[model samples]
Target: MKLPESQVAALNAASATDETPIDRLAEEAGLKPETATQAVFELRDEGLLEVTERESVEYELTDEGAEYVESGLPEVRLYRTAVEAGTDDAPAQMGRIIGASGLEGPEIDIALANFGRKGYGDIDSGELSADPDADADDDPEAAALAALAEGGAVDDVDADVLDQLVSRNLLDRHERVVRTITLTDAGVTALMEGIETAETVDRLTPEMLTSGEWQDVEFTEYNVEADAPEVRGGKTHVLRQTAERVKDVLVGMGFQEMEGPHADADFWINDCLFMPQDHPARTHWDRFALDVPPIEHLPEDLVDRVESAHREGVGEDGDGYHSPWSEDFARAVALRGHTTSLSMRYLSGTEVGELEPPQRYFSVEKVYRNDTLDATHLLEFFQIEGWVMAENLSVRDLMGTFVEFYEQFGITDIQFKPHYNPYTEPSFELFGKHPTTGELIEIGNSGMFRDEVLEPLGVEHDVMAWGLALERLAMLTTGAEDIRDLHGTLADLDFLRGAEVTY
Candidate 1:
């Protein structure tokens, strides 16, 4: 049988010894620990070696612990400095003692606190004196640090001093699994028969084949399950992929994409939607407003019509809000909280040419909200906004559109809850059952536009609109419990690496 050079070397070393730890064997053979581990496992898989593991503790020096190795322990430095300065007779000034010890900042504080607590020194009224009889050579912590400058097994060090050093953050404790490797009876027999150590080519070259020499050479056996090097290639982010899929789905259903600024005038976002200026949702705490570049170029005629709709309700028997209205507030710019602003702009023919009846528009874009981030919420996320401007549309049409849109993602289970929106009359919140949990989770908001909203947009036809959470849809489709796993800096890379892109 052919084996890797590392495995062949390790087996040879084990043939001479009864049993050896994998780490010690790696060191003696000049092989990397990880390489040794991989070879040992392969050998064990072939029944040529037997391995056993036991828990072992080890120590590594902390920043302060390493420093103490180069410059004695803090207490030892304090004691040495004070002794040289004549202690117990005339006390040295605290500053002078510290300066003479060559300690600074946190080190000065550490030395002073530890010196007095360890009975190595006495501090009185800013003057310091060392215990004249105390010896600096008996520092157990210093001795421990010196011995462990290079890490060692826990049992080999003083347990009391190790604990003290750990508590002081001078050393870090780690538990390790040490593997003991020994050759099996079969391994001995195989070595006795003959073990090949010379390098063997894994593949035959064209030159060797042409020379008719490949038949005389031995090629290494290939283990398909062996670990391979990682390769990373360029690809769109998972969230971006979801957004593109959304656009594709909408376009396939005869919807034109709407593109606009992330920072837009409130006129298109709320005023055109017939939301009153004094609405609680318009508060500064809820929306982020821009300071520079005030929005001053809104179409005057459309603004006037929207203002009238807000001041006095549209159509017969409709009463308008007698509350105050301001042109400046509507003209001010802010980060849009929803892509419904895009839908409003499109439905009103402000973004595109005058819209005829039987029109459909959609936008998959980012929106901002002043929100606290959690597992399900973020300060910013993509909104899948869509609108259908057709004659005599109803809540049923809205529900049907949602069902058809979600069905493309293999989501057949859907339920609607009666919901309220200022712009849409007879609103409903759409929900889908999670594939994993089977729990109904709200996914989007939809309703037919009210006359108060459509009249200001010059749209006499019924318009159905909905704003769905793109991240939530990604979570549902990807079987992700937390929205962060689908969208955020902390998104799980392993999940993304293995996640299958499905329609």
Candidate 2:
């Protein structure tokens, strides 16, 4: 049998009687660890070697531990300074010793507390004195940390000292799997039968392939199932992909896309949506207000109409807030909490042209909220906002639209709970059963726009609208347990790399 040079060398180095680590075999064979690992797996597949794996914890020094190794440990430095400045009978001021040790901030507290705990010194009445009997050189944690500063297995150090170093945040420990390679009975037979590892080619060159001498050359066997090196080509982000899919689905459903700024006036985000200026949602706790460049150039006529809606209500039976409503408050620039702002802009004929009956508009865009982050909530995320303007749109139309939209992504189980929104009358909160957990997850909110909201926008037709969390949909589609892992910094690269894109 013939093999690559790496595989041949690894097979020859394997122990027939006793187990040997792959690292040891690699070193003896003058091969790289990864190269040896590949060779070992290849040989194992061919019944020419046996491999075993065991997991162990390995420890390495942290940045602070490395710094202490160069200088001394914080307590060691404090002890040395105390010994130099004071005798056994006459202790130096604790503050003076700390300043002289060059430790600052939290390091000073660390130095003082650990110095006494290690029996290296004493602190009393603002005075510092060395133990006289305590030897800095005899410190086990410092010695262990110094040894590990260069890096080694955790088992190589004293457990007590390792614990102390870990507690001090001086070392990081993580589990590592060790592979041991050995010669099986079949391996010994293969060795005795004479194996060859020379002039094996992984790829065929044009010259070799064309030449008659190619007949004498050995071509490497291909394992099609073997993992290839990762080739990261340009691709849209996972969240962006979800957004695009949503756009395609909506466009397929005959909805025109809406576009607008991530930051907009509260007039459209709130006032036009019938959300009062003094509403708690407009406060700093729920909205991120911009400091520079207050929103201006709003259409004067539309401003008066919206202001009237806020101050006294709109049209017949429209009883406005009658509370203090300032145009300045409506013009305050802030990050949008939902893309419903885009829907409002569209419905009000502010972005595009005048709204016509039976027109459908949708936007999958980013929105910002002053929210506490967790497994399901993010401060910034994309919202799937869409609205349909038609004569007498009903709640069934709203629910049906949601079902059809989510159905495109294979989410079939949907339920709606009666909910409330200032702009949307008879609102409902959309829910979807989690694919994995089987729990009903709140997906979005939807309803028919109230007369108060539509009238100010000159939109007289009954309009159904929705604001769904794009991240939650992405989470449902990608089987992501934590919303952070769907698109944020904490996202799992492995999951993204292997995630199957379902239409």
Model 1 stretches with alpha carbons more than 4 Å out:
1-8, 15-48, 51-180, 184-200, 229-236
Worst 10 residues of 2 by lDDT: 221-230
lDDT of 1 by residue, 361-410 (tens): 88888998755445566668888999999988888888888888888888
Write the residue-wise lDDT of candidate 2 on 249-343 in tens digits.
Answer: 99999999889988898887888888888888888667889987778788888888878788788667878886778888888899999988888
After superposition, which runs of candidate 2 have C-alpha atoms over 4 Å from their true positions? 1-211, 216-236, 501-503
| Candidate 2 RMSD to the real structure | 11.7
Write out the backbone clash pairs for model 2.
Answer: 312-320, 313-320
Scored against the true structure, residue 304 in model 2 reaches a CA lDDT of: 88
